[model samples]
Target chain A: MSGRPIFTRPARLAAIVPYVWMLLLFLVPFGFVLKISLSQSALSQPPYLPTFAIAMDDAAWRAALGLLSVDSFRLLLTDNLYVLSYLRSLVVALVSTALLLAIGYPIAYGMARLPLRWQPVAMMLVIVPFWTSFLIRIYAWITILQHDGLLNQVLLALRIVAEPVVWLSTDSAMYLGMIYSYLPFMILPLYATLSKMDPALLEAANDLGASPRRAFWSITLPLSLPGVAAGWLLCFIPITGEFVIPDLLAGSESSMIGQTLWLEFFTNKDWPVASAIAIVLLLVLLTPLAIYNRLQRRQLEAR
Target chain B: MRANRLSPFNIICLTLGAAFLYLPIVILVIYSFNASRLVTVWGGWSLRWYQDLFNDSAMLAAAWMSLRVGVASATLATLLGTLAAVALARGEGFRGRGAFSGMLYAPLVMPEVITGLSLLLLFVAVNAERGFWTVTAAHTTLTMCFVAVAVQSRLSALDRGLEEAAMDLGCTPTRAFIAVTLTLIWPAIAAGWMLAFTLSLDDVVIASFATGPGSATLPIRIYSEVRLGVKPQINAVCTLIIALITVLIVTASLVSKLSRARGESAAPL
Candidate 1:
């Protein structure tokens, strides 16, 4: 105990390495983003004015600052479409997280209850699909959900419907695609938490004359809260910024935050406004992001 | 009790869930072998698309470019990530450690579109041309965080006593780490490297913003081609990518299983 140097000098120096890299690469780039957001939009070579033109006199500096208006932000606030798109993305993300948890919890519970020898292979099966190219998976969905696609062919053959329904480019299709793509993220964590749980607690609950369902509700669900939180955060964060799936699967109905941001930057070339939307998006997500970091930090320190 | 057995309710849920997860990709793999030019039709099986893919020069270049980026970035990311993990797992008191850790972990789940846009803007502001190096930089930046997570978990689980004993004996801190700690965490580090490689190989959104003309990565090429229609050529490419990733994952799992089976008798988890 006496030999332990908790705050060693070598370790402190080692800590500086990542900080310096983050300061230069991570923080400075974010500062650049803030500066660009404050800049004015224009139709020029760079499509935004006064970019790193630091040679201005004091008088020119004021003029440049004045020109670097908050109009992009103002426009974002005033526009109903922008506001609704943000809300829509949030709604979709939350709903998708819910769907993932509902479907994933049972599978995770089942896998966790299986014999120990089969657990590793079962976990691998869940993960291999997740590790595959995300784009290819989305393509697979498109093929399945298209009007004359696989789903339609099967339904027609089975006489489930008289004709092939228009399943692609609809809200239902978008939701299905989102859940399919993100289900693994939900299952992995839930399984991790559930599989490590003590079986005796449930046995005790049952031995105390509680029904099996009551024991599950009283013991199992509450116990898996950590997994549920982790799984929810994992699915929610990325879905808010999801673009490719919605763009591919939905018609003009779904206006996700990522889709709006992409259109502003790529199609409209509105760099200032696009940056503003991104900055606003970050601010909105700041709470969940902080909570996520805190949760991770607590986990790290708990060990 | 009967509850320990697989109930019919759970059996149904497990089967449906498994089918939902696997059926799409399974069908895609099956369709990749179809002789029909159209994705919808099921003609006799043939390897014509695979042969056609081999003869396509543009795709060949994109594949080569993606390979180069994956290898280079995964190497650098593994090095830097291991260092960062060392700092986190072994480092003592340091100011702003919480915030520093946040920076490392935040990007793992950050929206790819936002990251792509922000990094592209940074490049434009600095007047750096977007191309291979930029894509590599973006990818390395992203993958390093994942690598750090893997290595950090392993390092944290390591026994402090072994390293302390080495330090007690005449070994310096660096030498102690190299001799005692590195050997234990080496497999985890290698797995993280492979994970980073697959991540970079499959990335498209970030590479889209970061790439310039004649430097399209394989995913970017595939994205453009798949946008107009799902061509059979892309099917061939996607099948190959799946095969490669599947092989890597199976091999990694097998290694872990073998190591665990042997180590279980020797040490407790």
Candidate 2:
């Protein structure tokens, strides 16, 4: 090793630069959200009361703190609309995650099983759509799911239905979009885990007389649990707050929490209520996120 | 052993999955050239929508804005992220390292709405105008974490001995890094920048929240137009974006492969 300390002046400066930037731009913003969540809605520019100013005196600070209340959160609990939206978001997240797993696991396993020379190409195919525009991908589905769109035309030609199915603006369309959009997120992690698995273990299982299916369950499935959890959290956490798919594809009957939050901020201009929804949503997702972080740490340590 | 072979069942799964993923996009591209006003009805293939898209000044302006923001933010994110990757990979036992790492990774999974809401609130509190710079700042913050992760992995995998050998030759630390480490990690840095740019261009939710008047990005504009109904112009725009992204990704991959092969051959004995 060179006769140099680890934390040189430039290295310390490098760490401080990103740390301060993240603290101000990333972490401190959450502080504002929390403060705004406690304040009351108003008719002013930002449409909230008790806005905290940094230059305020201690007396003013205490007064602003006094104005803070849990009423917005209380409203979320007591109101059927908000309560149903949260529950709906959770159900959608859970169900979509399961569907993604069902669809993605096999595809990932298939990609993992691809020949070495072709595996990178297969991985590229899976990642291409991921890098494309989210809105455009969703829009593509809209075109295909329209009343007189390709899906309907094919169905009509095949005599699958007498008329075009009411595909758009339904829960089914929404779920289809969810699975399509998030499939890559699920597949990537599963592929990472599955491809890393040693074939020797499977061969040993076979030598021990375990069938392929038995080997998959006893050896493969258990080994990929961390990936399963990671994929589930990746899909579930985002789907719970998904605004675009439900907004564009799902019907107006029942909305997810993300839609509710959007309406509260944009339509109603209820910043406090929107902030409360955000806080609660964050709290709800914190568990899975923490679990994911722990899993990642374990994975990194393992490596 | 049979374990290494690609089973027919697995091959079928891969084929079906690729079809499912790609068919929609393929259909979208085909319909963008449709001559008919109706999206579903394909009058003989024509460039009608693409023509219509070119004349739409609002759409063009939004695309320009998105491009500017994407470039600025991607550049900023890459710089800060490379610094961060360096700090994480090389700096040992710094103060608040845990929090530093947590803050770096949190935004990767943090909900877009929350991030947008918080950033907007931050702008409001600071009395800063929400326009080009605000959107750029928000995109930078959101994307730098991804860049950090990408670069960090590459950094960790790098052989530090090469950097050390350069130092032993009497090169200053910064010079050694520029002459040696930077050349090796260049591909990851490039990948990080591209990822940041693509994400910035594609984001709708965060842009919708953080943007003010006269600063609507392409995704925001497309989203609004799409919500009204399926316009043929939107299809043309989407096709263009998809084509651009495909080219960029392919070119980047090829370049990285070339660099990797060169690096392999140039390895010292």
Best by lDDT: 2
User: For candidate 2, lDDT tens digit of each residue in B43-145?
Assistant: 9888988988889999999999999999999999999999998887767556887778788877887878889999999999888998899999999999999
TM-score of each: 0.95, 0.97
TM-score of chain A of each: 0.94, 0.95
- Name the regions of candidate 1 deviating beyond 4 angstroms: A1-3, A6-11, B1-5, B255-269
Complex DockQ per candidate = 0.54, 0.63
Docking class of 2: medium
List, residue by residue over B46-162, the lDDT tens digit for candidate 1: 999999999999999999999999999899889878888888887754678887899898887788887888888878888888788888888888898888999999988887887
Model 2, A74-159: lDDT tens digits are 99999999999999999999999999999999999999888887888989899988899888999999999989988999999999
How would you encode candidate 1's per-residue C-alpha lDDT over A1-303 as one tens digit per residue? 122464255656766666776666666777777778888888896888765567778888877777778888999999998999999999999888988999999998888876677777778778877788888888888877777789999999999999989988888888888998898889988998888788888779888999989988988899999888888887888899888888888789658989999899889998888888889988888888888888788888877
